[model samples]
Target: MHRLIRRPKSVERDLDILSSIDTKGLISRRELMRRSALFGAAATLSTFGGVLSAAGQEGGGKVTVGLDSGAFTPILKTFAPEFKAATGIEVEFASYPLGNMYDQNLLALRQGTARFDVFDFWPNFVGDFGPFLTPLEEVGTLDELNFNDIAKPFQQLNIYENKIVGVMIDGDMFINTYRTDLFENAEEQAAFKGKYGYDLAPPKGYKEYRDTAEFFTRPDQNIYGLVEVTSFFVYAFFINQLVQLGSEKGVRYGELFDAEMKPQLVNEIGEEALRRYAELTAFMPKDLAQAMPWDVGRQIFFDGRVAQANWWTDMPKGAADPKISKVAGKIKCARSFGDVTVLPYGRAVGIAGNSKNKEGAFKAIAWMQQSAQANRWVAETFEQSLMDPWRNSMFDDPKSTFPLQSESGFADNFASVSKELLASPKAYLDISIPGTNRYLASIMQHVPRAVTGQATPKEALEAMTAEFEETTETYGRDRQIAHYEEYRQRMIKQGYWS
Candidate 1:
């Protein structure tokens, strides 16, 4: 994977945009929201109508939010006009490329300039923004919404230094998406069974997965068995396997660190995970080094060039879309792969403590997450977008899968598999705390080296362990150990360890 901090994330480009807009003068609420009828604004209009009616006159403000230029953009862009019309808050937004957003948001928040009111916050980076973000509990929910409604894993993520720094914004977990066309092919399946002594099907575990990958590698037919990805996505692949391998091998890495906060990333489990990851590189496209960037691999798979890849659960929506995917209607999702099918990821958002319009920002968030809007985001899509659902309500709703089902053609299959996997006992959660980013950066550096053959998996992990120790020392081992202890307690309370 490339470095965690892809670039400087300097806001020099943002400053140029800032200079053009007059922050000193507020735009008239009516004028700003005048174009509210964009993107079937029906769901929001009635909700905001009463608020606008109560104003009697123009009594609105502006709320600028920020997002990574990924999933948030399409939905946010569609909803902005309605939010503006309802609250009289001119919605101004800025999006950084997904790779650079973490550092970009950090620069903006640390500089004490609330460049955006409502900003996207990933759990892993929430600790870094502790000083600058308003705790969710401190602000209170918009309509007394129960914070308990979100899944326990996600709820656990928002707690930082005993405070709720962010709220879950999207539901994400990795799962295997493979072309059913290939797996179910009679000739291919028979050949696979003959060769590997198993039916050609979705892998129940990494071992079977490797065998399946090997059976499908046919470079001459211009078809690759898997798509290898780099950067943070690759890290997910490595760590998820490591976590799973730990249990099967009778060495659980579930707790990540021991009671003393010593990293357990250099042991047998780490070596095995790295070895499996490196082995997968052989089945990836021939043009790339080890793997392609996530976007590249995704497109390759959609074009029917690659057979399978482990990616976010939402990938099937794109794979099944007839309009864009060459392999439309041929995708299938497997909920569980014996242990954790794939790693799960969750993102949370918080209002900047220094936000110029916290009230509007809060309202915007509430509006965006409302049932209708949430459902629309799920169903309404012409392309693959982020709008990943996080709420239990969404998961339970039969109607929520329509949009995805429409695109992926596995409406029932996707829903059942996804819900089961999401609630799987083996789901892996990302590390969240002040020093995690730096520690993960240390990992990002060494693990990829091992994958590319510069170092042995054990050697790379040894270097990772040393660097992790140094980072722990730099970030105060005592404090971090306490945080891990606190997380442990939460896991116990929630049965996350069970």
Candidate 2:
């Protein structure tokens, strides 16, 4: 029946399992037999090895960790070896796509599978999965871990029911990553200022951002002014956008959601705030009107065909790699456009509720987040550090091995922003309202329609309100009202509404 191929991984010392499922009539009998024999050998060895490992761990042995595939792979590859050498403890890591990983972990925890010792948690779902994540309070004490070194807001973001559940391992700031070479030209700058009535510098607020986008846009030249992740809450890009633009929110971006998983805005502030999304999208690439945030949008921006763009910390590497990017050298980092209160995306590491090897998993996470390992990973990965607060402390330090900057003190430029993030409180924005996942999805889908003039702001807000109300009602009125109340307070403080 089935043809199999036998192969051994020369370097890793692992057996390969290969199967030839296709049985087309094109191949001769002798060839088929040869291929099948090879396949069968490899499959046999692979099965035998897998059996031995399973038998070895039948009772219990090591900590199993789940990581989101993609960038995390490179990060672990770079740091795991060092941690293993230093501690003599090895962490078994399982990688999967973001959606699949979360679902698998969720099911495993619910079924008490104990398939994972540690799991990655997102800020939005951190609260949702609180019941399933092992509270750090039950395992390792934070005091001994020097929890104070963790930025305050970020620390708070990980707490659920007043107990810390997740520790942010990497910090990601959202800002405009633009082509400096394009903006540096005097003629381009003059024309931009003349058309937009503002200097051709970075956008400070929503209006300014739009003006500049329109000014630089030369459809006939195949060049556009601004390129941003066109998602429903690209409006939330306004979260950082607002702060970077000099409009301070009532709550710090980091502290938007608190321990209770309640909305932190003052009133229906998100509604009006979303209006800016409707306006700004008018100037973005048309693909945003109906494309996923990470799909093709980033690739286009990194190609250098677009003038200015916005994204999280990892965007640099995405746009800078020579193989994948054309405008790498032109990309320059800057302070986020709108708010002073920095809201960094959190990469949290926590023990799984059903983990069998709690101690082992904690050891791995500790090693991963520790200053030395995290610093090295930051340097190697170039994915901003949420664990290390200093953006540039390693520039001249002899201990610093990362080759981020050629000259000394260049990192100091990031210090102010880094310090602000670390010092600011971590807010629970993404997970604040129940059904936020759907709400955010709806925003991503509908907001673009409104932004591109397919729907009016009032129409978008009305639809959002209707959906928000329905989702809240599904959760219960009392809970919804309570969240609205807290949100109202936050808005009043920020001056969104009286």
Candidate 3:
């Protein structure tokens, strides 16, 4: 029988393991197999509970969810009915501003209010809630759920001391969204290729990225190159880049307790990465440096005012709308390249540690992540599902490949980038340090100095090292170092390092 063949689109099912490519370097085959074996076991266990699929649940009691307001409203609302029908549990959903949603959730969790059964959290806040979240391993073994199919690095992300404590709800991996209309022109493409000795594509490294930014920067046309966010998300993105510059694990070595964990005062490579970040952004418009620029940063690209943007998956949708996006037909997507590395961030979900409804909560959390709810959400919302593989089937979906009145170039570009991201093995990282919020805030202030030629990279690294040491010490270095060690071992086990 001849099977129908479909082409991949920017919105189609992705084949790239966008966040899975490990850059910690080579390791022994035996170790590689060992980690793979553990992942295999977890993957098998992920799908073990087929008890009540996302079919629909009914009215038992309201399980409240504290969620950040996002574009996936329709999908989220749709799931409520399905979940209610399947489990007889009604959902009481409350939306919050992104700023303090997690903090609010934690406050409620710590107070043992049971006001919300589930809380929506970004990866940065996962560490904050780790101590309070009930490990998923307690409710369902990794063998039961087919965890491997979800995404490459998510299961490992939920782990704390061998316990799988969370379930991933979205596949929000980072990618470079570029303006193809500007780059695809024969003259522009030729000029870029001639200058760079490579095809005119989204940047593959920091130097190229900077060059492209400068190349496409036509301020006369109100267009800029290399648009970036300087918010909390930006800091996480910065951390990822820092890892790419350094050896395995970058500035964050393993925990003090872990054998693989080493205490390092500074990583020169990481310092350089931060320096580059600040230098690039120093040329950015001043208003772009605020704590909330990412939300509006994509509009700069969508309006055809910027040549390229470094942002998460949600940014592309801004360009999807024809009215708002002058470059709706021209925008494209790809992974942000650097030394061919993928440092995973923001692929975390965890249960509250002090919940009375542990069983119900686990079931609810697992249902949202494992069932059709997650896959359909991506299909309908055009948002990248959390940083994982649920979108794999959507790679070539018809809806993703629609030939709209807009140019096909945008779709094609996005498709190519998504494919590249999905094809690689994912590398996961933790931002759940006890004082990550404060540390990142400080890094934001100081890292820019180094990038803008104010401080040497070594100076920046020393400052960061000192800041981290001070904060971690105050927040309990022993505990924080333990988590760092676990993170390091995880990288080693994944063959990110020898």
TM-score of each: 0.85, 0.72, 0.76
Number of the top candidate by TM-score?
1
Candidate 3: residue 18 Cα off by (Å): 36
lDDT of the candidates, in the order given: 0.70, 0.55, 0.57
Per-residue lDDT over 131-237 for candidate 3, one digit per residue giving the tens place of the 0 to 100 score: 77777787766654546655454445656565666666655566777777777888998998888787777777777788888788766677677667665456656
Error of 3 at 43 (Å): 24
Better of 1 and 2 by lDDT: 1
Error of 1 at 287 (Å): 2.1
Among all windows of 10 consecutive residues in model 2, the one with the lowest summed lDDT is: 14-23
Model 3: ten consecutive residues of lowest lDDT: 10-19
Query: lDDT order of candidates, best first?
Result: 1, 3, 2
* Candidates 1 and 3, the one with greater TM-score: 1
- After superposition on all C-alphas, the RMSD of every candidate to the true structure, in Å, is 10.5, 12.3, 11.6
